[model samples]
Target: MAGSFHGLTVFNNNVHAQNSDSLSQADIAEPLFDIEKETYIGTILQNAANPTFRFDPRKGKSPSAFFAEVDPTPSAPGINEMVKPPTFPNVSPVAPDGLIVSSPGFHFNEQNNAMSAFQNALVPPKPNITISNSETDDGYNVFSKAGCIKCHAGSYFTNHQIIPADKIGTEPSRAKALAKTAKIFAEPLLYSPTENVPIRKNARVLKIPLNNIDEQQLRLGFAHDGKGGYKTPSLIGLYWQAPYLHDGGVAVGYEHNYGLTGTLLKGKPVDPYRSIIALVDRKERQKVIKANASLHSVHITGDGHSFWVDQESGFTKKEQIALAKYLLSLNKGRTEQQ
Candidate 1:
């Protein structure tokens, strides 16, 4: 028996021992098999400890004890399972500072109200110019006269309804337009009437003055005055639309020319009456020039002549700041849904 015990101990040494102190009886009950002897020492020990050690021949041996095992039942998920859903890309909740003209005053807390009042006072309202054309009551007519509606028409401030001029009525056209325009595929554009359009009250909140201005007075000239100039963009939610201009040139300041080339404005020097140049002081003028110079120039062939525009031409610092405020007012949950 001693010799048998020695041989069994030697053979069983090859099998890994569980920490007896840490492991429960259930963990060690399944014995590792001795291939040479064709017997399970761990199981023998378990049966020896019990008087009812009936080796039921009907019961088959367990799977290889050497193999690692995994629990078949799924474990509990981590805390991330409880998190909120992701927001739509590029679209964000309105910042407290981003109040628009059309936004409800009730949304403002006392602190927000104080900040808005300070911003309003700092940026005094510009003189509201008379608009002659009678299209729609709210400055949609001004937008049209300025040629904004050709591209920006519709409730969402974009003509998702219009196919791009280049690829009209084709899959490629829809794809290209979707890529360039934000309103395409955007939740606000698809479901909300005013999603693309910024709230007007938020514009007021941003303190952007939106009175009608004379269209002719704002045209571009030889320095790249209004030749291919797009209509002035709508102020609806202007806060969100940064890096302004159709070509995305001027972001925080205004320029007198839309093209980058000095040549565009060289011959036609912007008519002061029709340009941002007329409103700013010498210091402000320098700021506009600096901002315009920072942008890249675009060249296109026209009327047998090569012309360039700065692309940053129409935005001024004052206008940019005010426009941002006006845009903020166009947040969701402000108006009662129709």
Candidate 2:
């Protein structure tokens, strides 16, 4: 105490105050990226085999044109549907050895179709990861482990397969969801059973088989047969694709359910942070709550089930954030490292 520090105290205090202000500003301000710096870093980190493809959104050019040019052709009725697969236009057939054609069998009449199919086939198989390491490489591992990949695999982020929970033997889970909705609906004094409830009408049509494990069997009755079930949605670029779920019930990244607005139900918000804007108005809040309740009911009933993180699965908030980050990166065309 008797001996003073070597450095000047006044000078040190002034420097510290300046540094504190700098730190405070940094904390409050949004981070900005240097495009040139990012590009340089990206170039260095780019994978030779799976190079990240960047396209200018403002230019409004066709994304497909970047890869190759192909004229649209009518489909053969018996062979395939005219609707393009999610994999179309993104995946190409160029062989690793630089060979254009990978297949030997090509018909003169079906040359275009064959080449298209071959290109699709040539697209590299999706990379697989186990749970422990799945979250390692930019957290895409969590997506694969969570069974999200089962439905959302490929360039377009979908397998284009309509998977039914009943077929997957999750009818009991669906029943639980429906029961929850019914209970919520019963509690709302404003929600009259007689009040032209479109959702109630929609829910009545769901016919889950007592014993069905095969999706094909389930799909015969449940796949949009007026029961309102469809293929699992691709989560590709899901960041830009907001208002999550098939019915667009909940806005992406927010807890507020789109259908739950204006319904009397008491529960924690689905996405409280993102839903603040809607919740500002009492009427709007009611509408969002009602919409969410409807969606929550559907989710529980297994009509349109998306995975969630819970203690049983060891998917914590941290993991969910990591998974969300990985998904957002895909939307931006950024690789796992980014």
Q: Which candidate leads the pack in lDDT?
A: 2
Candidate 1 lDDT trough over 10 residues, lowest sum: 76-85
TM-score of 2: 0.33
Per-residue lDDT of model 1, residues 48-97, tens digit only: 43344323334454322211121121111110101010121221112101
TM-score, prediction 1: 0.22
How far does residue 90 in candidate 2 sit from its true spot (Å)?
A: 35
The superposed Cα distance between candidate 2 and the true structure at residue 98, in angstroms, equals: 45
TM-score of each: 0.22, 0.33
Q: Write the per-residue lDDT of candidate 2 for residues 1-338, one digit (tens) a residue.
A: 00012112212222332232221111112222123433432332233232334433355544333222221222210111121111211111110000111112322113333334454344232322122334446467667777767777766677655455444333233222212111111110111212221222222221212232343533332232322234555554444443443434444134434443422234433442333223222344345445555446545211234245443457665665556556644532224324
Alpha-carbon runs more than 4 Å astray in model 1: 1-138, 161-236, 253-290, 297-338
